[model samples]
Target: KTRQKGKKKKKNINLNQSKKQSVSFVCLTCHEKEEIPLSVVRDFDLMDDGDPTTPPMFSCEKCGGRMYPEYYEGVHGIKYRLSDIL
Candidate 1:
């Protein structure tokens, strides 16, 4: 009996990274809007002081003011605003 040798095929791996989503943020003081990465927002939320009442916030590059997500739903399903922080 004769045995045949089989060749192994290499698998094509895709190293391409997925695109991150950009969230819209608005400056509380100046009302200026900008697009920020969702990963960054999640990182900020993770680094927060364990406060579930407040959402992740950022500093406005234009006015040096506080920026919050244009539309954020907290743990209680309530939209948080600058007034909520203050």
Candidate 2:
């Protein structure tokens, strides 16, 4: 009997893939949410900026720590990173 040829391995879309799109974000610094283009934001979030495997940590202008989105709000107010859009 003849042996079958080696089969090709399928590529995993999830494991290795970087989407190239003009991602937009908003930086809630002062009193307004600044619209950030992907080109601008990518510069700040570059691999060289932080640990290659982890996201960069930045300080917040409003409160402290990181500031992005305010998905959570209670008796006080929505707490999120103003940098979330960044």
Candidate 3:
């Protein structure tokens, strides 16, 4: 992994709207959820700001599958599912 040093900028992702400081990552294949700090996520551009259909930046450690963010809506209390497009 390449390490870059500087101030980490925050994106417009809805994680800020929540009280929790961290977000959850779900493995596409294994269905395992891992709650990771937002600082770790800021290291890379996981979600494409230009396109919501873009894939995530990281891969699963256990199964080598793709890892995507699990976005939760606080108002209606719903989780948005990341769809896979072939």
Candidate 4:
């Protein structure tokens, strides 16, 4: 029974890892809509309050851009253009 529970837990973990995230957002640099992957969400444990559920940084695969996942309050999510990286 113990071993069965362990396997079930592992399966649940895998299910969470297997989740694919895709959202369309305009590239800050190019001003063109791009599909960003959820897997690209990276954790900044030190930068944040150690909340892994909410990833703080995301990179744009198309333009090699990085920005915060801010989409609330008065400001919409800030998008970074390729030039912004420099």
Candidate 5:
């Protein structure tokens, strides 16, 4: 009888580490920047009250200021920025 070859081992991958998605945000108030998870941003959008005029935002951990995605466009095709708001 011929000897059978052993099965090859597969590399173990950490899904959490490999599938992590993040976006950079800049705080309009303090100009602080941070990397936020895409999931968190989606959750925020899901909880929003259907305000198409507003853009997704998060609180800055450093300054407690409003942080917006570095490049975001509203539903109305408007690009929002701190300078334009002020």
Candidate 6:
């Protein structure tokens, strides 16, 4: 019998580790949009009180006005608008 080379098996990758979860924020005054990591959302305690719809309001660094999550998209293919979440 002749020895033959074989292809190695591929391994599954952690999609979450590859791409970070994030949310999109928009400043009501300046209309500026920023995409931040999900961790930041947690830091802001947006998920507190067991309300996924109501995220804490933030201040815009540029305009000093209120910032809101106009749209939030996660790495796991989840997406929603402020109204949708609410």
Which residue ranges in model 5 land beyond 4 Å of their true spot? 1-20, 72-86
Candidate 4 regions off by >4 Å? 20-86
Pairs of residues at least 3 apart in sequence or in different chains that clash in candidate 5: none
**Per-residue lDDT of 1-86 in model 4, one digit per residue for the tens?**
99999999999998876553443444445445554454333223234655444334545666766443333111124343333343
Model 5 root mean square deviation, Cα atoms:
7.1
lDDT, residue 21, candidate 3: 68
**What is candidate 6's lDDT per residue for 1-86, written digit by digit as tens?**
12222222111234554354666788878888877777877666634555554565678889898778876543333454666644
Question: Alpha-carbon error at 7 in model 6, in Å?
Answer: 15
Candidate 2: misplaced stretches above 4 Å?
Answer: 1-36, 47-49, 68-86
Model 3 regions more than 4 Å off: 1-19, 46-56, 72-86
At residue 56, candidate 4 shows an lDDT of 48
TM-score of decoy 1: 0.59
Q: Counting only residues 3 or more apart in sequence or on different chains, how many pairs clash (N, Cα, C under 3 Å) in candidate 5?
A: 0
- CA lDDT of every candidate: 0.67, 0.36, 0.56, 0.47, 0.68, 0.62
Candidate 5 yields a Cα-based lDDT of 0.68
| lDDT tens digits, residue span 3-54, model 1 | 2222211111222222225567888899899887777776776677766777
Q: Which wins on TM-score, candidate 2 or candidate 5?
A: 5
Considering every candidate listed, which one attains the maximal TM-score? 1
* List of clashing residue pairs for candidate 2: 26-85, 67-81, 67-82, 67-83, 68-81, 68-82, 68-84, 69-80
lDDT of 5 by residue, 1-86 (tens): 12222222122234445455665788888999988776776676657776766777889998899887775544456565555566
Candidate 3 has an lDDT of 0.56
What's the count of clashing pairs in each model shown? 0, 8, 0, 2, 0, 0
Indicate which candidate wins on lDDT.
Answer: 5
Better of 1 and 2 by TM-score: 1
Q: If both were scored by lDDT, which would come out higher, candidate 4 or candidate 6? A: 6
